[model samples]
Structure formats: structure tokens, C-alpha cells
Target: MYYIGIDLGTSAVKLLLMREDGKIENVVSREYELSFPHPGYSEQNPEDWYRQTLDGLKALVSVVDPKEIGGISFGGQMHGLVALDEEDRVLRPAILWNDGRSIEEVRYLNEEVGKKVISGYTGNIAFAGFTAPKILWMKNNEPELFARIRKIMLPKDYLAYRLSGSFCTDYSDASGMLLLDVKNKCWSAEMLKLCGITEDMLPKLYESYETVGYLKPEIADSLSMRHDVVIAAGAGDNAAAAVGTGTVGRNKCNISLGTSGTIFITADSFCVDSNNALHAFAHADGHFHLMGCMLSAASCNKWWMDNILKTDRYAKEQTGIVRLGENHVYFLPYLMGERSPWNDPMARGAFIGMSLSTSRADMTQAVLEGVAFATRDMYEAAGSAGITPERTMICGGGARSPLWRKMISNILNISIDIPACEEGPGIGGAMLAMVADGKYSTVEEAAAAIVAVKSTCEPEPELVKKYEERYQSFRKLYPALKTVYGEL
Candidate 1:
């Protein structure tokens, strides 16, 4: 049997074809555009996502025997608000998770509504990017459009709904909306009231591996696949990526160094941080996980190397740096503001302690180390909640850098493993499809059988010690600059 995993990302929809035996047969990607209608606001059309996904599926299924295909699933960008009217037309371009238009709404939720009350109800505080804030933004600014909202959906759920004609979502993706009563895996009534929405607007929730329904006859015919192709309720991009890296069950960890950085740690039981610093979300494996995200991770390096330094050879830039933690130069990677621990939109990027003698190598090293230090900020927050992992699986574009990987390992004082296949969320979405098709017994079984760790990066004791001190200094810079960020 065969399965297809669709990774609906911000830029493209990546389709992966995998056989039951764990071999990836074919992979294809189709790009889409993200529009910034105004500064700090991001949007995308749902029609574009569905159109490209259908095209990508045709290309993916064209190579293999159609009869061998079993099921399909998705791993998608989380927290984008997709709304539909009574007749099922998209109400507006989806307010993407990265959109910062909800600044006033976010403040109202966090301050006026009270952070403690929010944390108590939903196990998370409001962020400009979360679905609830975006819903509130629409409610306040676009009341006529808001009144027509009959259904509220996430990015991938829109694809699933269009495919199976089932209005469904997975627990993993729903958690990011700031609407789920995460511990209980249900929508929070209080949150619904706060956003002036009701339970009827929400979709049915399922585990990431559960099959929602089968493909529609027309979709199946267009892709030349079996009509029995099961449509599994897929996960958020990070959760699916974690599952792809085999970060399932208790005490498992995965770090993704893509455009954004995340530390995903899975658990057997539900737990929430006091301040809700780390997200308490249901995992893809029918359990729970805590995630801490840094808004800019590898993107920080990309901005420095491509825009500032005017170079595309990233490896060549890293070769000039010699020392890991000794540089006096420090960078605060709040270029896109920030999310996780500090939900401050006023936070801005800054370079601290730069001197006349600081060389180009020092500045470059600071960017790399700055991301590591920021990642460690979340690592510490996870530890505060009594969750700690001895080792973590690492993936994404930045993970390819040996120096960056080593810096992460030493700074966090934990071992980092590299997977043989860096297919990421696309592979994880496929793995969920396999499980939903009955190719695997459970998410853990699928991960154990399919995911392979090819190498490990271990931290040296002396380097870890040096980084521990540097991280201490790094933590103090943000708070001291908090007042300054407001003035600017």
C-alpha cells in the first residue's frame, strides 16, 4: 500500500509519496505567494492553497500505480484563521499566523481580559498571531464580515474539508488557536464567548492520525487515485515534523531550525506552565506536548548573510568564525518581535556590545550564537515546567550547518541527533496517512519503524560551561532593553 502526506507550508505545498515499507517513492512541491497588504500584516488566499495542492497531488500520484495508494494526510502551517460563509465561500484571505495586525486585540486579551484568566481557561495567553486574537481583530474592525462567519478553520483543515467534505481538525493544530481547552482536548467555552463566537463555528476534533473521511469522488478522479483514499485529520507543521523525526511518547524531543525555531517535547500526561510560557498542546501521537517557538531562528542568519553581508554562500561565511562563546558581540533576534516567553510586540532586534575592534567573524558568530541562546530561553522554560529531555532530534535548513548544530548542542547541554531523511513535515504528514490507513498500529509504531537517526552531536563539557555563562549574560539583555524597545 502507499500513502500521501501534504505539507501545506507558508510558501508551498509539499507532497510526499511513501510506500508501506517506509521508502519515499516520490516528492513534489508547488509554490504559492504570501501577501503583505500592509506592514506587519500577512495574508494568503485559501483558493490558492487548494488549487496548488490539487496540482501537486496530480504530479505526486502520476508516477506510482494508483491502486497502491491507501490514504492521505496533511501537516500544515498552524493558527491562520480561515472562515467560510453560509454558502461555503471564503470570507476573506486567511489571516496568517505571522500577521501582526492584531496588536490592539492581543493587548485587550492579555491586559483587559487578564492574562491569568486566559491561562486558566485555555492554558495559553494571547499573541497577535493566535487565531483568537485574529478573530477578535475581525470582530472589532470588520463587523459585517465577522457576522457572516459560519465556520472557523485552520489552514490544513480547509484542505481536509475540501477533500473529504468533512469539517474536521486535529488536536495538535487546534491547540494553537488559543481556543482549545488543551488539557481536555475540547474548545473552551469562555474563549468562544470572548471572541463572540460559539461552539457551532468550531470543527470536529480528532487525533492527528485518525481518519476523518475518504476523498471526494471528483478529487479522487482528478488525481487519478482510488476513491477509497482515506483523508486523515493531520497535525500542525511542528507536531508532524516532530513525529517525522520520531519524537513521540514520553520524554522525546525535537528541534526544528527552519524560518522559525521550535523545541517540541512530547509527554505522556498533560501539563501546563504557570505563566503558559510554553504552549500546552495535544501531540500527534494521541498524547500531549509542550512547544516553545522563537519567531526568528535561521531567518536571522539568512538576513545577516544574504541581506547584510550580500552573500549566498552561507557555509563560506561560517568558515571564518573560530570561537563559539567568547565573542563580546551579541545579537537579539527579535527582528519579527517575539512569541514564546516574551510576547512583546515592541521588542526590536539589536546588536549589543559591538566595539571598534569587533571583526566580521565576531558579528557572524553572534548571529549564530544569538539564535542558540534564544532557543535555550525556551529550553529553560520547558525545564521550569518539569519537562526535560536528555537528547533531541534536529531538522530543517539550519540543522544542516555543523557549526550551528554544535552550538545548539553545547549551549543547551544536550545531545542533538540528525535524521537520515530531512524531509520534515511532509514525511510526518505521510507517516500519519500511513497510520490512518492501518499500515501502522499507532504513531509511536510508525515513527519507530520509519524514522532513522543517522548521526548525533554531543556537547563537550568545557564548551558547555562556556556557553552556560554566555547564556546567563544573554538572558539579562532582553529585560534591560524592554523599556528601551517601547521608546523606539
Candidate 2:
């Protein structure tokens, strides 16, 4: 038997084909358009996701007997509001997790409603990237559309609805919506009232490994797949990536450097950060985890390489950077604002301490170091909560860079484990499907078998000391320019 894991991302849908024995048979990716209709606002056509997913699925199933495919699941960007009308029509373009247009609504939820009250209900405070704030933004700005909303969903659940005809989401994905009572594993009635939405508007919730339904007949036929292919309730991208990196069990950790960066820490019990810097949420492994998410990570490097440097040669560009933690130029990676620690939506990316003698390599190095510095910010937050890992598994496109991995290891002054297969959420989704199919009795068992550490990058004391000093300086930049960000 084979299983499929679909990782629906901000820029693309990545599909993976995994066998019952845990071998990855094939992987395919398809890109889609991300729209910014207004400054700080991000949107995407849900239809684009369905079309590209179908195209990618066809390619994935072509490698093996399609009839052998046993199950399918997903891992996707969380907190994107995908509302459906009475007729199941998409109410509006999905507001992505990186969108920062809900500042006013976020302020209301965090201030007017009070963080203590909101956190009591949802175990989280409001951020511009959270779905409840987006809901309020819509209700205030697009009253007609908000009134018509009949079903609300996270991004991957929208895909599940399209393929399986099931309207459901897993607890792990729903945790970011500001609508779920995360610690309780259910919708928060208080949050629903505050957002002017009903519990009925939300999808049915399930654990990440639970099978929601099998494929719809026509949709199965479209991909030449088995109609009995079970669809598992998948996870949020970070949770799914955590599963992929084997960051399950108490105190296990994984660092993901995707479009957004995250430090994921798995816990045996529900616990919240005192300052709410790290999100306390349900984990895909049926426990709990704390995650610190930053709006931009690898995207920073991509922006510099594609938009600024105008080159596709990432490796070549990185080869010239040898300064490590010694670069005088510094980059604040707030390209799409920031989350975790500082929930400032008005924050913007900037370079500090650049001089006329600053070469292209210095600026490029600054971008990489900036992300690493931001990642460490979360690591320190986790430390304050008394959850420190001796080492962490690292995944994502940015993790492919040896230079960046070294920087991350030294910046945090911890050992970094490189997964044998670093496909991130795509592989994690497949592992969840494998669990749903009964290939493993539990998610932990599946993870132990599927996730492997290929190598470990140990932090050098000298490099760690240098980065510690650099990080202190990096930390000061955000505070110094914070007020200026709002003025801008």
C-alpha cells in the first residue's frame, strides 16, 4: 500500500508519494499565485490551490499503481481564513498567514478584549496573522461577505473539502485560528462570540491522524486513484514539519526555516508561555507543543537573491560569504512584519550598519545571519519557559544551506541535527497518512521509523561566542526601530 501527503504552502503545493514501508516513492510540486491587493494584505484564490494540487497529484500517482494508494493527508499554512457560503461557494480569497492587514482587529482583540481574557479562551493572544482578527477585519470591511459565510476553514482543510467532500480540520491546524480552545481541543464559544461567528461556521475537528473520509468518487477517478483512499485530518505546516523531523515526545525540538521560520518544541502536557511569546498549541502527535513563528525566514534569502541580486545561483552566491558571525552589516528580517516575542505588524525589514565598503557578500551574509538571529530569539523564549533541548532537528529549504545551518547552530549554541530526508511538511503529512492507515499504531512509532538524523552540526565555542555578541546587538535593533516602524 502507498500513502500521499500534500503540503499546501504559500507559494506552492508539494505532493509526496510514500509506500507502506516508509520509502518515499515520488514528490511533485506546483506553484500558485499569491496576491497582495493592498499594502500588508495578502490573498490567494482557493481555486488555484485545487487546480495545482490535482496537477501535482496526477504526477505523483503516475509513478506507481494508483490503485495501491491507501491514504492521503495534508499539511498547510495555518490561520488563513477560507470562508464558504451557503452553496459551498468560496466567500472570498483566503487571507494567508503572512498577511499583516489585520492590525486594527489584532489591536482590538489583544487590547479591548484583553490578552488575559482572550488567552483564557484560546490559549493565545491575537496577532495580525491569526484568523479571528482576519474575521473581524472582514466583518468590519466586507459586511456582506462576512454575513454570507457558512463555513470557515484553514487552508489545507479547504483542499480536504475539495477532494474528499469532508469539511473537517485537525486540532493542530485549528490551534492557530484564534477560534479553538487549544488546551481543551474544541472551539471557544467566547472567541466565536467576539469574532461574530458561530461554532457551526467551523469545520468538525479531529486529531491529525484520524481519517476524515475517503476520496470522493469523481475526484478519485480524476487522479486515476482508488476510491477507498482514506483522507486523514492533517496538521498545520509547523506541526506536520515537527512530525517529519521527529520532534515528538517531551522536550523534543525542531527548527523550520521556510517562508516563515519556527522553533517547535513538543511537550507532554499543555503549557503556555508567561509572556505568550511562544504559542501553546495541540501537537499532531496527540500531545502539546510550543511554537514561535516569524513571518519571514528563507523568503528573506529568496528576496535578496531573486528580487535584489537577480540571480538563481543561490549556492554560488553563498560560496562568497565566509565571514560567519563577524559581518558588520546587519539585516532585520521583518519583510512581512514579525510574530513571536514582538507581535508588531508595522515592522519592516531593514539593513543596519552598512557602509560604502560593504560588499554584496556582506549584505547576503547579513540576510542569512538575520534569520538565524531571529530563530535564536525564539530559542531564548523557549529557554525562559524552562524547555531547553540539547539539540534540534533542522528542516526547510534554508536548511539545505550548510552555511546557514552552521550559522543557526552557532547562533543558538546548540547541536543541529540534519534529517536524513529534509522534505519538511510534505514528508510529515505522509507520515501522518501512514499512521492513519494503521501502518503504525501511533504517530510516535511512525516518526521513529520514518525520521532519521543524517548528521549533527555541533556549535563551536568560538563561533558561538562571536554570534552571542552579534545577537545581542541584533536584538537591540528591533527595539530601537520599533516605534519608527509604526511611524513608517
Query: Evaluated with lDDT, which candidate comes out highest?
Result: 2
**What would the TM-score be for candidate 1 when compared with the true structure?**
0.98
> Model 2, 258-346: lDDT tens per residue?
99999999899999887999899999999999999999999999999999999999999999998887899999999999998799988
* Per-model TM-score versus the true fold: 0.98, 0.99
Alpha carbon lDDT of each predicted model? 0.92, 0.93
Q: Which whole-number lDDT from 0 to 100 does residue 200 have in model 2?
A: 88
Error of 2 at 450 (Å): 1.4
Clashes of each: 0, 0
Question: By summed lDDT, which 10 consecutive residues of candidate 1 come out lowest?
Answer: 272-281
lDDT of 2: 0.93
